[model samples]
Target: MRKLFDDHKTDLLVFGGLILAYFLTRLPRLDLIPIFTDEAIYLRWSQIMAYDASLRYLPLVDGKPPLFMWATSIVLKLFPSLDPLLSLRLTSVGGGLFSMAGIIFTSYVFFRNKRISLLAALLYLVVPFTFFYDRFGLADSLLAAFGVWSLGLGALLVQSIRLDVALILGTAIGLGLLTKTPALFFLVTLPLQLLLFNFKTSGWKIRLVKLFLLFLLVVIISQAIFSILRLFPLFHMISQKNLEFIVTPAEFLARPFEFFFNNLKTLLTWEVGYLTAPVALTIAFAFLRGQAVKQNLILAAIFLIHLLYMSTFNKSIFPRFLLTFTPGLLVLAAVGLDQMSTRLRPSLLVLVFVLVLALPVYTDFKLLTDPPTAPIPDGDSKQYINAWPAGYGVKEIRQFLARESSQYPKVTIGTEGTFGLMPYALQLYQKDYPNVEIKDYWPLGETVPAALLEASANHPTYFIIYQRPDVPPNWKLRLVASFQQGRSNDYLRLYQILPED
Candidate 1:
């Protein structure tokens, strides 16, 4: 062990620094940002699954795979005393760190250059897209990590034909599939390995047979593990829910040209432009210079396959969907930098790195200081703060409920959403408080629910409004507390219902 450490001391030191940097950026005030609706739903599912095994298939009802929630449940069970939401976020942190390591390994495997590998890892460490999602309590980070490692191990397996690498790759692929639906993209991109394979080698026939067997082994193992999702009846819901996002074959065939053009426009302008500007520039430069053209083309093919798959299927493209290819982009960018450094001056490479990273680093700084009001586009901080039914005012509202619970025998709170962040956020916090009864009132614009009005006639009630400012004028409620984003008039209001005689 000492000898090993001594031999790779530089690598070890660099990794240590990267890990520290990751934690510094991810761990401090981990729960500072409000719990997003998805985060709340995921955490609540884990909470349910931790104690009850029968409900392990709960996330499938919402078209979600169960790996992230399962992992979260295990963490919560192990550390029962820790903050539940924070524990869930920590799982994503683990996934992010593993993803960084995977980036390094993948870069080394492909380019066989330590400088490019290290640079890829560094870029992943600091990129705002990566940094923000790594801290978030979502399955995207985990999916990205597993997808990256699977691709890396798949590359190594193709070269070495090692059983151990095959097993690891299969496991990573399985986990990725179980994490989210986008893992299918990794499988879709796997065929591009044919471009990387050498056909002119000695004993090519035998080598191809062995490679085929290994590939089959990986698919079988991954499928076997994935079959666990089918244990519940709601497993079919995954396919059903997925259909809502994607156009049917008949619909696509009828409007193929229109569908293709629209998807292409959205893909280039929004998905690719927003998340991978630097990587795209690097690819363009590589193509222009005709450097590593074959490898770059292969990478581009993989990226485009994933992009086109997402564009075709994703009705509403979210920023998080792009995470599956983030490591690939970073690796390509690293290759671009390394190649450019050889052609141009080394200082020019540094300048390119600085320019590429400037905006992302600044955005990350904003997220760290004031996440709720960060000026990041399509970020959880800005997007979910006051607009979404997240846990922005949840902590404050919970405090109010706790205080009121002591004064009254029973306190009831009605939230704007049924199962989303509002009521679920309060539900997560108020689990121990048996005196508090949390209810949901859906369809935000409608008048106060008759049930809530009837409940208010019996006792004092509170209504939490995140969707709109005004409630019915006849409801006779006073605004007790309001939580606002920094310097923003938009806020979540909690109103206390006045008792009616």
Candidate 2:
């Protein structure tokens, strides 16, 4: 071990092991799970891009970035004869790999010890939450990759202070913004930190003012070009995805302290994923005391600010949002481990490290094997359901719809759930029949179209109504397929409105 450390190859071995573990744990049964509704939405948008070379509008379904869609589209283009759920999600795998790389690169920045950096990379790579989310066809993993890379590069820029380094940092941040809007935290934080650092030294006098002006000019120019290319509409849109809910200054002023407190509660106790108490505490201790811990601490602060913003409007503040701080967390954890080893026997240090990391791994493994049963006990049940929709039978419903749609092209579907799944179902099932057409009542607003309803009644088309039976219904619609999901049953009844009625 001492020789391995001396040679600086220990970190490489650890980083390689982490990459291996990530693939082993996440790659298997990738195709086994059902295509989630959100994944389906991304796939559908990707299909749109496959047809049109230029995007017509902001493909921001509920304010999500179009990068995921672009990713899916590229995958489909590369592998035309691939499964939508399985092939498309490889992009996320790519993102996860890049993020692991970021972890190693960032750790190498502060420690300059290859072994320590590799260990940090390994810890993040094997982290169950990281692996689980990394495999999913969501935007978080990709955003996380860009965010971490930006941080690592930003650190380099601070150390080297080269114009080329600035350009690289700007590009990484631009990509991150293209991935998710919240990533702007990093873009904004860098200059603010520089200002703060200078202010602390110069007391906000002549030197600080000059530095601030130069920093502001550089930031404005970089962001102006990045925003125009990525977001296009400037303040109107945010990289084709956005925070759907707008915030006002009044809202921020209304509860300044509450925002921080609420985010604190969520960050510590969020259970949709792993929140290993022991590891968290260890990392916290390192952040408070370790060398260069101030930067990591500030990153955590920025992440907390983002969490607070999400919590204010009751936005989904999943722990995945905290992925931006992952590199910092890993570094802090390494510092803590290094401290432990220094203070105690090597054997004791090993025992404590294993225990801290192992508990979360065990719990997350259970979640991987059996998701529904492994939800955070105190949090609401729906939270887990939203996180992993493979637990839901979205795949089964898609297959069923496909097999039935072959016989009739004009079948209409109605459901209370997000209606974005139908077009994706068509994309998935279009393997055999490439020219299949599905005319479904997907957009809820379209369901109430008077002219379309009248034409449907005259033509005598089938209505697939997925609604609760207890609710009041129209007399003309007839019951057909009733699917039960857990305690709730969705009635996919066939309804034919009578011409006279």
Candidate 3:
């Protein structure tokens, strides 16, 4: 172990610097992106799991695996002083750091080139894709990290044909499966590692048999780990929930091109915008490196196959789903960058590299300072910044309620929706104020809930609405505060339900 450490001592030191860079991108103003519906839901689950032992499986109620929440729960426990939302965001930061390291190791392992590896990590550091996602509380970044690790370890297993490597690879995939259902594709793609196998070597027959055995061990280990979810009957909800986001096999066969055409168009827009069109264009230069064509083919497949498959059947697709393996595209682009560094004239190369790096760096700046106008797709603004689902007013609402509770012995709050931003986000901050009582209502009718009216008799009762188009006249609501969710005209309005005269 000491010898191995000595051999890679420089690499280890460089990686420490890279990890620091990652946190610099992640840790500042972690809540800059307002807690959206999903973050609210996931972080709320993490908060619940940390407080209630029996509810460790709470996310399973929504068809999500418990690993990201479980991990976030640990963060919440350790950093009790930290904002629970910020603490939970650390989970994605850690995952991006892990995935950055995986990019370095996998690039180096595949091509035996330290320059290519360093470039890969550097690209990951600056790319808008990682920059935007890594700093948020989401499971996609963690799943991407596990997917990248599995890629690196799968390569090692193929080259060494070792049971130990397969064991490690399977463990990574198992953890991924425990994070998101999309990880099952990792299990499906593991066999493609044979593309890296050395058929040119002598004693090929025995090596083939050993490879088969090790591969089978990998399947056994990953599937066995996945079966842990089966302990709870809600595990079946995972498959059921999947039907909501993807075309079933039967649906796919029936209308393969129906959604595929438009979905593919949207995905390409997301990829080009986030990937930075020039950086993606440079991936073509990877072919110039003159390594085994099969090696490049497999690496490209890491991103390509997943994109195509998701485009084919994804009913509820988002740019984040592509994050799992799109860093592989960066590994390929890193090779291209490395090759240009060697082949181009010194001055010309500098110009090319600077131009290539400019957009992603600028995009990162916009994302950190102001995301609504960032160069990425409008979809981001719709979901996270501008839409009803956005949490533009959530923090202010919490602070408002916190103050109201202090001024009065009892404060009653009503939020628009039951499950996500309204109730869950508000509930997360409800811990300290014993005087505050928050209840949720949905499907607003012509009149307010009688409970809100009853609570109003003695307590200051306030209701929060997010983009409720036709707030009922019978609500007798007076606007206490209103903030535009984003550049969009939609406002998150706080109204105190006044009792009738």
lDDT of each: 0.78, 0.60, 0.86
- List, residue by residue over 1-501, the lDDT tens digit for candidate 1: 999999999989988988888788889888887777888999999999999998999999898899999999999999998988898999999999989989988878877889988878877877777888899899999999998888788778877888888888888888888998767766667767766677899997898899889888888888777888989888888888878777778877776554555666655664444344665576555556675565666667777887777666556566677787868877887787777778877788679878877766776787788765454454343455545445667777777778888888888888887887877888887755669888887765445666666778777688988767677666777888887744446678888877656
Provide backbone clash counts, one per model. 0, 0, 0
Ranking the candidates on lDDT from highest down gives 3, 1, 2
The prediction achieving the highest lDDT against the true structure is 3
Writing each residue's lDDT as its tens digit, candidate 3 over 1-501 gives: 999989999988898898888888778878888898999999999998898988888888989999999999999999988888888889999888889989998888888899999989989998888888899888999999998889889889989988889889889988999999888888788888898888999998899899989888888888899899888879888988999999988998888767877888888898878889889888889897686577688888867778888888888888888888887888998988988988899999989989999999999888888877777777676888877888888888888888887899999988888889879888887765668888888877789889999888878999998858557876788889888877787889999989867
- Give candidate 1's TM-score: 0.93
Q: Which model scores highest in TM-score? A: 3
On lDDT, the stronger of 2 and 3 is 3
Error of 1 at 69 (Å): 0.3
The reply for model 2, stretches above 4 Å from the true place, is: 1-15, 60-63, 192-225, 229-235, 239-243, 254-260, 271-273, 287-296, 305-316, 376-391, 405-419, 427-437, 440-472, 475-501
What's the lDDT of the predicted structure labeled candidate 2? 0.60
Model 2, residue 8: displacement in angstroms? 7.6
Candidate 1 segments exceeding 4 Å error: 257-262, 270-280, 286-291, 346-349, 372-375, 379-382, 444-451, 485-490
TM-score of each: 0.93, 0.78, 0.97
Task: Please give the RMSD to the true structure for each candidate, in Å.
Answer: 2.4, 5.4, 1.5
